[model samples]
Target: MAQAPSTRLAENAETRKTRLRLWLNILRTARTVENALREEMRVSYDQTLPRFEILAMLERSESGLRMSALSEQLLVSNGNVTGIVERLVQDGLVERLPVPGDKRATLVRLTHKGEAVFAEMADVHERWVNDLLRAVPPETAQPLIDALTTVRRQIQQD
Candidate 1:
């Protein structure tokens, strides 16, 4: 039997079409960028994108990341982050130290190996971003970043 074509009610068609198009565009852009990042990470550092991101987060932290902080930053569960951290520690890329003020909390900091890997990772990450956005006029970059930040803040609001 032949499948019927997509049907839309006269009144709802345009609005639904606009929404569908927007979502499709978002998905496409996200998938493309994510794939590029993952490929870059795999080839350049022998790491996955999530692992690279986790390392970058720690690199930017002045005091280092707590397990809870890492969880939040990666949007993953504590169990997940714990395993990742353990692997990193075993690789001599990260150090788990006792948190001074909080006896119960442990701090996760990059070790010398971690710093070296992350510094190279950071360089590659920046280059990837720049290359991807090179077609976008430089003047639009700041406003684009601001817009995305605003969206993130709004989504994260209590």
Candidate 2:
């Protein structure tokens, strides 16, 4: 037997409300984290988190990543990523190189300066995470990370 339509509608509405609440709370926390990172970057390093993220991503990638790939990884629109990449290119933190086999394609690689910046940023980034997480005991923090990862994986799977 099929379930009634109204029951399904009510369930969906409740789920949507619950999801919105969760997202709102998560956004609030993220904003706080961003502000803290921004302060650290500006006051201590004279760099922004986005610049750090781009350099860090390049540092971890062997040959580097394509603009499209970087957009996906950064979860930003292609145009936005392009603009950031252009700025970094001008700053000499990154350079775009021809994809030898693909004339139409290009890959962005970190320069020596970018790598140095990334190394410095990484140390401060780790300390930021430690300071943020230290407020909660490891037992509590570990479970939170586990739970959040589970939820993120489920959402991504969908």
The TM-scores, one per candidate, come to 0.80, 0.81
Top candidate on lDDT is 2
Residue ranges of candidate 2 with Cα displaced over 4 Å: 1-22
With candidate 2 superimposed using the best TM-score fit, by how many Å does residue 54's alpha carbon deviate from the native? Answer: 0.9
Task: Please give the distance, in angstroms, between residue 48's alpha carbon in candidate 2 and its true position after superposition.
Answer: 2.0
Candidate 1 minimal-lDDT segment of 10 residues? 3-12
Q: Which lDDT values do the candidates have, in the order given?
A: 0.85, 0.87
lDDT of 2 by residue, 18-62 (tens): 989998988998898889988888788777777788888899997
By TM-score, the best candidate is: 2
What are the root-mean-square deviations of the candidates from the true structure over C-alphas?
A: 6.3, 3.5
With a 3 Å backbone cut-off (N, CA, C), the pairs that clash in candidate 2 are none
